[model samples]
Target: MDCTRSYWNGRKAVHRRTMMKGAGYCDSDIKTKPHIGVANTYMEGSPGTAHLRTLVEKIKQGIWAAGGIPVEFGVPATCGNVANGAEELKYEQAARDIVAASIEFVAKVHRFDGLVTVASCDNIIAGCYLAMARLNIPTLCVTGGSMTAGIYKGQKMVQAQLDVAVLGGESEEVLLELEEHVCPSFGACPSMGTANTMQMTGEIINFVVPGTGTLPSTDNLKLRRSKEAGEMIVEMTKADRKPSDLITRETLMNAIAFAMATAASTNIVLHLIAIANELGIKITLDDFDHYASKLPCIVGVIPSGPYTVVDFHYAGGALTVMKMIESQIYTNVPTMDGRTWKELLANVEAKSSDIIRTLADPLFKEPGLKILKGNLSPTGSIVRPTGVPAEMKQFSGKARVFSSDLDSFAAIERGEIVAGDVIVIRYEGCVGAPGMTELMVTTDALIAHGLHKSVGLISDARFSGFNYGAIVGHVTPEAAKGGLIALIEEGDIISVDTVQGTINLDVPENIIAERRKKWVCPPPKVKTGLLALYAKNCRTADEGGAMQPWLDDETN
Candidate 1:
């Protein structure tokens, strides 16, 4: 089997087939060389994908010891800890159409020449960033990393945010013997939420492998960086280099300015507004609040900070926050490693000022993430812009609507919240909760009973970058398209500003024309499967939470 390679149709195939051609090995040692697919989301009760099947058996022994011919594939997970009896928005729109039609049917019907993805959590890296902007091949995303330090009762706890803080006061067979040494084969939950801020902002926009996004998946440098990413993907399948040659718009505005100075996850502004509308490029949460008011939070982990994701990979990853915002990045885009994010932060070395912070010394002067714009998100709602406060950023509050999330966890078990109320959730979104759950046990029981600075979670759909407060996510004509957060009521007043991005509902227009003459439109939660084709082709998180016909050719 002359060192592998295969492609049955779109050219190249002296041999080597098998999406399952009876598993053996050489097809004339993969003729015509260069077929590297590897996608692998992995779930059957993933102990974080059992360290991704031992880093896919060392990336198939480094793609057959590096001659290129690694066809491995399997994507199907997102139960978010086995949520039991299905229909959890059909397992999140069947994980965004099984990673958008399996990277457009494995690169135009078995026409591979590079694709590696891997993934860890949070809807497997938002369905692998909408299948790497629709599989522009020669890809490389390997994040079967992060899981170590869990130790409850004397602080430090991560690996699955189940900080029952003493396992919710013990008993119950010591929570079944600490779930048998709590699933660690390291690889996700070095806690900075949304699966380590979308795979370290998908390797600060190169889609993984520069400081291998917080390596850990039970280390050995994640099995020698998964066999040096299968010998650097046979030199990116003989130098073809796809992934839209380094996802542009100046590297997606340096990954929305490093997810706005690491205040990451409002589901990374809904998967960077559906991977910049699958790359027509228009990412707004007001361009994540104009790059979170001119960037500079410097990797302060967690629901906002207190580290993890292996404490942001020993405080270096994103090459030391791109060398402390090296003049707010764009240093001529290009990477998967052809060089430049200013040549990998020219030897970065910022070993902590409390995990990289100092653009003239700063941490929380704002930019955890906030971008609201009135009439209850008239196409704007996202709050986290750093541990919120400043009088809970201009809310008027009173409304407490909750038509779902199990009637707001039965009003948090009938404690029917008080202290400046305003929790409005609804039938969730993405064309009617066809997959937008994660309010994370009512935003961690309103931040473990401190009323997290006087409550404020207003949604339509989407949450859980692992809990933090003053919530408001992806709310656009949601309430299943009847927006106005379903013409809200229960004691309306709802203001919410978050630094002028808005959420208003201080109603007036004839009491919203008397509730739009009694709106109805509810019925289609699952007319059939794949959440009835993403509730008939999803779109509207102000047009970039994907499915506006899978965005691209520069979306309108």
Candidate 2:
């Protein structure tokens, strides 16, 4: 046989991959086989995980078929559906550290040629990004896909919103049925929320196959994509390429720009910051607004627009947005296939006007989130302009704040909170709330009374995926840490000047200074566990909501 024919026939020598994975084997097994790592996040704590296990099995088959061996590795699981508060915050930061470490350790032990990460949830996607940075391995993430759009009275909603609405005050019967109907399958959120955006970021940065990023878990297309990714990983492995090739500093900026233009989850800011920090790169909220200007808000997804990820997939997926924000994304950045961002967009176009708009008539016209500086937030904070009311864009409202998340919750349930209220959910920062937990229940209550849509939430923490309001999260120097947020009290008048890009309390400097002296940190919820660890080392949200202990390690 000719050399070409022999080379093609010899593609079946994947057994060498198994032997390289620290498994005892004879030299005969060491053929010129490509080894692939299947970094699968399959744990019972999260519902979307089941799909990953099933998907990994298919990846294994595809690796063998492509003349590559696939070694599967597992990482810690973070279940958003169950955990809440600082404990959840504890897990979020830990997830990133754990995944990055796991991938590095596993790859070194297995000698894998490339990696295929199977993930879907919000934390999982972020964790995978950190993992990709650590191993710097030829990597690809095949998301389980967002869950089918949840329906209520034939109207579709995402899972997080459904949970929030019910928890806030809807009847248990309605919530139960809606919960069952809302997320009927195992997938990611269909909304243009954090989970969907992060997964697509992987594709836009040329981390995953472009068009394959938005398929849902139940769709057969996801399985086909998984197989294709398996094959792609084998090819990447043979090329000795790693994730850093695709996820360059330029790509990180592109991802941030996309997140802002789409008005995606606040989680992206934190996630991207952490990923950059892990890679020894610097990214700040200013970069978020910097790229936000050139990019247009054309993506038609919820909280920002009217569609879901399902509609986005059929319309154009990441390619659609990339084409719109081409200028924002440096076309020079390298990709997984050794190509540039422009090369990836060559064959793609915005197929549907509804899914992806053009700059001439962009949906948002500018980035959805804006960075504001004021006496209130000396460092900075990010807020979704789309979630806020147009009339109150430049409001000088009173600071009807809560000292803590629990007090905020109590006020909402008691009907004490109302529209035009500048609800301050404080002490829930990296060192304060120590977990940056979502006050979904409180936001839901405001939603129930039609107050959520109008009121603005300013806090030193995070929000739920389902939320839509003029909520501002991740306030720096949080109340517990003695930031201006602690000085806010119930009935204290405050001001929000979006036009001027400032958020400040109306109180005099002398009075505010007096309030500061009396402010005290809230007591710890738990005396032990990761929460304790988080309390001891976690930084403010502006610092990527990560543990401060690791801060010195990176610098060291």
Candidate 3:
């Protein structure tokens, strides 16, 4: 039976049908077509999502052509670059949950037969997938795609380069030129940052249409794919092809393998775990580690390599990369197009060997990302091995602790952060900051000062996908919760070995115990509003930093 029947089939729904007709929908439109919810995260001033309005129009056209009623609705969207370096940044991660809850609230109330989620950027895409898993409905995602790379001095440019130049003391004229040209079009940053990472990974997990993730936002093809997604979702609903049917443990494993091979964002770890939790599927840091050990980094996108995601798209995108590592990923999994993975890439070929390398001749012999565990992070911590230089991979230095990212950035600006100092930024974890803020500003400062390789950094806070260097982040049992990071004093030694996957506080065990004994959990940074509520309910980073009210319910 059509789920929309509950609102339009009988005399009981007369008022609903009247309201629908009043809104310009006719009787046949209400009775003969399925209701497809177009959950669009479109907001002006956000390059990643600003162009989504056009896609939504095309999607509606496709739905109408496919005999479905398209009901458009708004969802929260945020730009990490806008929120970075401010207290407002705390709302960034929290926005993910808001997007998920918002979609759930509206879709459940209106009883959408199928959903077409239009989103771009990191949190928005992750949140949409979380919503899909929570509702277990027939859904397809439309990623806004990557922006075209900007050209400065005849060299391609992306957000990371602009960030480094701004802090590197470039001339005002040069900076102005970069500001104007770094983002030449409306779309996600033209790199394998969180936005593109989630898009590509989402496609591999079967939540997105094939070829849609890598298409440039300005390309005419993206609009066509949006319409195709709208039409595909209607058929998926008729077949009862719920998210659960497409996304399984094997599919997630495939996503992880793809991420590892491509050297995608570390943020994928948190988003993937959150989506898995919504589906009652168990995924942990160990799963990431397992794939990291087996899969080699092949894609050479920005922050980890010389190319941007535009180059990646031209290099044959996700299908080419997947085909390159087919032996490492699952091939029997179901895709959104009703085809198996093997069938999807049966005739695919890589267009550029330099951007997407073969398994035998990978960009890096090691995985792009790794999970580090030691006394410092009893639970776990994340580091991107592909971003670290070989000389700094196994380094030890004196601790220089700061309570916040701002303080750390200030010290870097003041020339107080010297070479061989392991900068420890704390009190910015999920519950500590009330939302785990990205440390892009501080990382950029380090890069600007030429300290990225000479200095090391560790944080309870997270890092932006564009950040690199000798850094570790998302230290579980974060400093605010009185983790070992909170106990480190100035001049104490810390060691990080990305090759061995270990991050250790080199102080004596007895001394460390004493420090922990004296350590106290700090007061809440935010006392009221959404942040306070998030802090009260949010789980640790290792648990995906999700707000699981079920964990607090004793009745269950």
Q: Whose TM-score is greatest here?
A: 3
Q: Name the runs in model 3 displaced over 4 angstroms.
A: 1-4, 551-556
Model 1 lDDT per residue over 1-556, tens place:
2123323523443233553345765545445567778878877575566557778778867876877778787876663655521236336534765676776686667666777878777767677767767767677778877787566445565634453333234566756555654554456656676777777788877778788877767658678888888888778767877777778877877887877777777777777777766666666666667877787566677656777767667667667877787787788788787987777677676655786687777777676676777776666777775756566876677888886666675585477887798888877777777666556556666665656578787887776666666777777767888888887888888878777667888889898888989888788666786666766776666665556564434445
Candidate 2 lDDT tens digits, 1-556: 0112232225553453344535643333334566577888888756677668888988888887887767687877666656643235445654555566677788777656678888887777777877777677777888878777877788886765675666466788888778677777787767766678788877766666877788877779888878888888877776767666667678888788777656777778888887777666888878876865566567768767778888877777777877777766688887777778778778775654876777677776556677777888878887766666676677656677665666776787787877677888877776665566666666666766677656777888777555666677778877777898887777777777654568887789999888877877667755677666767775556767665367778667
Q: How accurate is candidate 2 locally (lDDT)?
A: 0.71
Ranking by lDDT: 3, 2, 1
My TM-score estimates for the predictions, one after another, are: 0.35, 0.89, 0.98
TM-score of 2: 0.89
Candidate 1 overall lDDT versus native? 0.70
Please give the RMSD to the true structure for each candidate, in Å: 20.7, 4.8, 1.5
TM-score of 1: 0.35
Deviation of model 2 at 317, angstroms? 1.0
Q: List, residue by residue over 1-556, the lDDT tens digit for candidate 3.
A: 3755667778898888888899899998887688999999999978999999999999988888887899999998889889777779878888889999999999998888899999889888888988988999889889898999898889888988888888888999999999998999999997778899999888898888877787889889888888888888888888889988998898988888998999888889899888888877888999999998899899999888898888798788998999999998889998887889988888787654889998989989989889999999988999999999787999899999998888998999999999899999889999888789888888999889989888999998888889899989999889888788889999999999998999999999899888877877889988998888888888789888978767546336
Once superposed on the true structure, which residue ranges of model 2 sit more than 4 Å away at CA?
A: 1-32, 84-90, 108-111, 167-169, 517-527, 548-556
- Rank ordering of all candidates by TM-score, starting from the highest: 3, 2, 1
Candidate closest to the true structure, highest lDDT = 3
Better of 1 and 3 by TM-score: 3
